[model samples]
Target: MAAIPKSTGMQGGAMAEEAADELTLLAERHLVQPWPMSGSIGAEARGRIEGGEGIYVTDAAGRRLIDGPAGMWCVNAGHRRRELAEVMAAQAMELSYNSPWYTTNAPAALLSGRLAGHAPDGLDHVFYTTGGSSAVETALRFMQFANNVKGRGEKKLIVSRQGAYHGSTYLSASLNGRPRDQDWMDGAGEQVVKLTCPNPFRRPEGVAAVAFCDYLVAEFKDVIETVGAERIGAFVAEPVMASGGVIVPPDGYLRRIRELCRQNDILFIADEVVTAFGRLGHVFASQEVFGLDPDMITFAKGVTSGYFPLGGVMIAGRLLEELRRSNHSEAMFAHGLTYSSHPVGCAVALKNLDLLEDGLLEHARSISGHFQSSLKALEELPLVGEVRGMGLMACVECVADRVSNNPLTLDLEVGKRIDNHCQELGLLVRPLINMCVMSPPLTISTSQIDDMAAILRRGIELTMDDLVREGLWRG
Candidate 1:
């Protein structure tokens, strides 16, 4: 790879000014932004990433920053992999678009077969979609369709958790329990029931960890009874609640949930959009990390390492058997996206998987302890309330007081403040209120992890300084 220029925009000197202004104008005038519900070309538009390689992204101005959030928790194999690029180009030239409805493409078949080997024991089937939200959408719809075909249309409710973000689609968005995700938007809320997130750090202050787990399990039981297990179709969860501040549940939590799902005949859907495909040092973290056999696993983001948008739901073979045995055999599930089985996406994902299986997964596993320990050291800083994560993913939660875990006001945008400082220090982090979510590419090294931690520490320290200066904090 050629040496990344320091400032590609200014390389054109005075002549580049016109093009940069044109881009800014177009973006400000036309391109719509997501999530923040803000104007297209405001400060909310982080920056234009011109190129990336090995966990570092160069902005249009050519300032490189460590991609701390791994491009929205994708990009497991890092950026600009020549193998992925070649495969994408080759596949696009060979077979670009096929109406996934009536015909299946070659790359799609090969990728599905390859993925089945990586999925949990019985999850051998794949239903493709454009991205995480749509993968979730497909999974939820499948659950509903399976129930309806089995003559149990009443069992269409999905149980999710507080702080969980399933997707942005109406059906999956309904399962989202995040506050910011719901405001100023509509969802199929009636079809989704939410339970408390299993974040021990944020659990009731007076409750012990063991007591908290018991309370959570009891709540799940009560909800099942209240809704009647027969009325519920499935229980959806993330192995480690990714966007919900990397909330890792206490041990034995998922196994208990698995037991409940099994006994109640409810499907267990693991949303691994951020955790799967080497993010957690595994192709599937549901069974590997949580020790639960999910009936269906919805994955995206890292599947193609963010090279091309793709995602899918992996179904257990048993579910297909049940659907086949159903008396309503003629009833089709009747759901799909235009890019459902996109060939180029599958080809790129295949190459990305090759990179992971060859060495990246093991590399991630080896460096994960160093990654966690390095981030955990941040807890010594007074501004950091907790540092929790597994594998290469983690979060540094900012609090007004470390002892009480009292959150800083949303108005402070503490995470954003830290992020601003971190960016100036040559790092990029995803800020969620007062929480900084960190999931670097699996390709990051121990030395790079140290660099990331150092930058984050300085950023947090700078944020604390700002707070103390503004009389917003004392610790």
Candidate 2:
């Protein structure tokens, strides 16, 4: 409830140095740099968030703005849910931490049971981790171990879609399809195979709906054939590509991929970090959106609404059997973190789920139709080359020429200007290359969504005018 500060960092803002001193010091010292991957910390490139509530974050300058990106598409239930905070505080007081190796807590048990009820069938067993990246790492490691235990030791290589973002950790980053993210790692390319991302908006001009699905299927088949089916461990992917510019796979895309994985005896790991916990209408996006039958589902972000860091992989019944059998031998999965399934985090996650199911999930689902319709309306805008996304997540691709759908020459500046204008108008959004994305918290009301869309439309209009003034667009 205190006065919030201006959001600095990636999104720029004007704030006095003295008020931001604490954030600067923290970033300079303990914050293990992320995103940029250079591990470079710019003093001016930081935002001191004093606190947050509902659909807005308050900065050190006591400014509150709508959170359009749901805090990087994680906080589905919004921020500062009092019940979750209370549950976490109580858990911290009673049992701050516990090792899952020998001691299991009520919070983890209850949370797992609740998750089982919501996630797709067969994805019932839970393996807790500290965050989404770890959840991804766990899925890969589990796949490898499970394969070996099942007498398929050669299944070691994992396949992921191009433009997919798994996480930024060692294995997770390796699994990420981003070229720049993998280029920094010496041997990331060796472990993971990248396939084409299914972009319905930019599908090959003449390809049929089924052809688009077959394109990805054929790509997977070719990769498996090249590597040998025995050499494949798992196929990791997002139910709906989130960080990779929000690419939504066409209708049959997921069904075909699921069939391919099943036919090949390869594990299918759904990285639902951003798509889980009611972000996509259902509890898990893979189940609700794609109707997927994955061997493992990695989750994080919205589990606790960003109130605390917690993530895990939900193991299918068959995979759990393999894990159980493997545990009998000396070759144990042997994967865990100190903060894995922390009591406080698990408690917070349980409470967060309660809040989400109480009405937030339906709230998000109810508005997705309206949100997509509004985004689709922008197709008439000459600068909007493509508008794509589903459920609560969506993006608008900005272009200089509508006919060719070519990216603007000054795409970066246009993107930055759009973001700046939105901030100036009390709305926030996430920018991915030439695309402007919105993933407002599931708790956002219809009226709030209207405000978000209006501000974003204004931002886009302003950016387009700026482009014209600079002689970028033909019109």
The segments of candidate 1 whose C-alpha lies over 4 angstroms from its true place after superposition are 1-11, 38-45, 401-412
The list of candidate 2 runs beyond 4 A from truth reads 1-17, 21-32, 37-42, 204-210, 323-328, 401-409
lDDT of 1 by residue, 104-157 (tens): 988899999999999889999999999999999999899888888888989998
Each model's lDDT:
0.88, 0.81
State the lDDT of candidate 2 residue by residue for 367-421, as single tens digits: 8888888777888877788888888889888865545454444666667888888
Relative to the unseen true structure, what is the C-alpha lDDT of residue 132 in candidate 1, on a scale of 0 to 100?
A: 94
- lDDT score, candidate 2, position 201: 66
Candidate 2: deviation at residue 440, Å?
0.8
lDDT score at residue 238, model 2, on the 0-100 scale: 92
